[model samples]
Target: MDSGIEIKVMNPRRGDNLVHPVGVGHATSASSAPLSSTSSPLPDERGLRQQQQQEQGLRQGQQRQGLIDFKPLKKWVPWIVPGFVLANIVVFVITMFINDCPKNSVSCVAGFLGRFSFQPLKENPLLGPSSSTLETMGALEVSKVVHRHQAWRLISCIWLHAGVFHILANMLSLVFIGIGLEQEFGFVRIGLVYLIAGFGGSLMSSLFIQTGISVGASGALFGLLGSMLSELITNWTIYANKLAALLTLILIIVINLAMGILPHVDNFAHIGGFLSGFLLGFVFLIRPQFGYVSEKHVPPGYIAASRKPKHKPYQYVLWVISLILLIVGYTVGLVLLLRGVNLNDHCSWCHYMSCIPTSLWSCKSQQAYCESIQYGNQLNLTCISNGKSNIYTLSGERPSQAQQLCSNLCG
Candidate 1:
């Protein structure tokens, strides 16, 4: 059921006809009973041999009917996903600690939380850290990544969450989707997919959305969904309710992607992570072909009539193609990003992918430009957008200080 399929087999015994939930390797027949000691002149070897052949034939038939779960059961405990959840929580706490909104701002939302109080709700509807705090903690900023050579932001941004609500939604999704995947595939594969997909998401977001800072694990979570879809397709023969499963997964993906159209959602990261994870899925989550017997599953002294290939020809073909596409896509995306290529300029309509403007809200990107002058331990910031100015007492200017104050002034 966790695999989104249930396999039922008809019991073949003559007397009591009953249908039962018999998965792969559990098929039974009346003739499968052990031979009596005095009954047969034939050697015990002959009986085992015949039994092996019958079982093999039955399994092969089951394979043709798609009644087998050829892939092995869960060999890994679910720990990596939980670890990811913990890591995100810890990082969010650190971000809030550094934000120190009560000290930094005139007032704070949820001020009762004291040092853990959130930035004003208008500034961050997600109830999270200040944009400057996020930027200092390695949020995704195109200017820093391209000009300052802070490529590490691509990976680090995924661990940073904007607010309590932002982390809450992402962590819940990670727990619901990630734990099951880790249990089925183990940590290494799932972990790589998570991290790489997140980087891919950041890379994509950096290329287009250069105006504001971005942070969240939405991309990584989307990558998990993409992988799930590809895993189902590549291992299509091993599953039941194939059409139903495919439709359900597709519907879920569509709905989630559609949600990205909302403002402030960062759909670019979601799309990028999904594409990356979809290709990576073909490379990492492939399964042995149906009817391909594992040597460990074979009975002793029974030789396989023919050794089937581990994967079907199409699987190998898909694997190669997906790998090539992934490499090429990453290389081109990185090169374009490092070169300061704004994908928005090249594709005017593409911005709609991230946000669609409606009568209720505008999708226009807000650019906060400011002039800053420091004198006698106080920095004065003037927002060019509205000619609004603010002065803050500071010993030294930090990189994101002017930008954060300007964002406030402009707002």
Candidate 2:
């Protein structure tokens, strides 16, 4: 054997090292042949499977998102504020329609918008401020004044403007502040802020000025303005050069409040509104939004609560209060009717500004009782006939026929 050279032999047992085909040794098998229609799904089948998987994921996403997601109530606060502002504008428009735009605003405009508002207290009942009333037949929802921190009025006094200018001014303020705040905070915050600020302003006004019947959403608007101001002050980063916007807003509000306070201005309401707005803006506006309001000012722990549906516990409270109000309102209505209050008793309420001038309603009581009647429809008719209650027929038939029909049903 040679020490320097060693002979190497192929291993016959190794699968890769097989002998030639003609040789007796096992022939090497070719590289593994391509799988015959078994390697993977067909392109079409794969596409379909992927599409199905994508669709399932999409459905799952949609399910989590929900239909008509009321979750973003906080995000919609600014929307609510602007909507409220719009409502006030609409009210002004309605007033314009009702008053027909008198040359001297003191007459027609004053009559409708300022019919019930806080004016300077005077010995004469006619001169002093009065409550805002909703004329229902002979019933009047007169404006009621509160004194000494009558906080409840904060909610109500917002609806009480002494004049068209006041309404216009306050509404304008709301428009400016509400739109911005709502867009940032969402509907829930805007709505709550408006309501709470309105309530707070009203309460503060009443607390300070008890005897006068002050009204108008101006106070709440002022509160909103104050909140905006506070927000600018606190978050100076965002509102750095927002001075023009702030000044314009302040001037508008100042002009309105000045008009109310300087000479005949209900300064109390303005001050109250301002303070309330300032306070609420701090309470509600402060506490920096989680990750910049985080899609709705959702608090750290209470985000879930904020995302709840519209008809939550608070809605239940609203419903309960609504029921209570409805019951009380209806009860009071029945009592007044029982007390023999006729349509003529409350002229301001019996008709629109006076009385419906149409001939279709034969009985004045029908008009008088219109407010008290439940589920009132256009066709439903209940009027007075010969000093007695009468129900009209849409068929325009004789009274005797209705009587027979009623008797047939009762019998």
Candidate 3:
């Protein structure tokens, strides 16, 4: 579902440029006598010196304001996005190797790849590993994380991809959105946004989607998109053509979120990541107000009559509100999750947000029941729903494992 698009950044113009003192020409013209009158007397040395000083201050203020308006902070070398890409690729390769689909099942797609072959299409249409393989590899499973104290899955799940298409879409979006933000804001801030937003996404997914394992970087990608929108708004005065940029970003976000409505797509993660990143944007992406002067720009022996505030009042309000919301949301979510509270029980209509049932396909969770009987060296599974039977070598597989296989067959 991921597609790349370029964002247009307009040139910044100083909105408050008129407030600065007028230039020397204006001052001289005002001081001169009218054309019909006799010529005015020459100004004194002290008066001339004062006028020159005033002009210098005016020029300095204009220069500093121009820098504030037009110049961006030092650009950061874009290694973080590339590094994340490499890390995700490495993890996917390792996952494929460990999956060894050929060894696990009687048949596998693309079997010529040996251990790297994908699970049967019926099992994993994403062209990746089986559910058992992903589960063992630290997919985000609510029961395991809550009952077994395997909390690391929250972080680990972000690096895991469900299949080839999943990783490709996510990584491409990451590169497109992430690199620019990193270059403008530096890696530390951008990295924090990615990780924290991902965690937030996982937390929400765990609460609502309790039946299956969830994996992918879609949440984090949405977080970056969320940050972009908030950054545009909070730093509203600095950018040119603000309305157009805002609308373009909104369109992109809306399209992406709409895709989440498809069956099997996790929209909770998208919403959670977006909300967290939006708040974080207000806290982290704030910019100085127009016409603000930095101390470094002040000339020796010159004191400004008055100074502009560094940030607008609205920015401060947003920062405080967002910070508080982030903290409370995380705390309340963690407490509820640990307590094993089922969110669906409280909100009857919430499930529809993740998926809407349609005539072409059903959104109900498939829970296939099957009876398994094991002989000395073989196992037989009979699906209760359709009375279909399949046999496989016992091969040390557990009861739960047999059930999963039967579920796939029934599906």
- Report the Cα RMSD per candidate: 13.6, 21.0, 14.7
Q: Ranking under TM-score, best-scoring first?
A: 3, 1, 2
TM for every model, in the order presented, reads 0.78, 0.39, 0.81
Q: How accurate locally is residue 92 in candidate 3, as Cα lDDT from 0 to 100?
A: 95
lDDT digits (tens) for residues 294-370 of candidate 1: 67665565555457887888999999999999899999999999999999899989999989999988887777788
Best by TM-score: 3
**lDDT for each residue of candidate 3 in 1-411, tens digit (9 for 90 to 100):** 112221221222356211111223222222232222232323443465687799999898877656544455678899988999999999999999988876677678999999999987887899998888788889999999889989899889999999999999999999999999999898888999999999999999989999888999888888889889889988887788999999999999999998887899999999989988898889887878766666766566555444888899999999999999999999999999888888999999998888888888788877788888888858798988888898878565543457557867787
Q: Point out where model 3 deviates above 4 Å.
A: 1-70, 297-306, 394-404
Q: Residue 132 of candidate 1: its Cα lDDT? A: 84
RMSD of 3: 14.7
Residue 79 miss distance in model 1 (angstroms): 0.7
Task: State the lDDT of candidate 2 residue by residue for 69-90, as single tens digits.
Answer: 3233333434566667666556
The residue-level lDDT of candidate 2 at 60 comes to 63
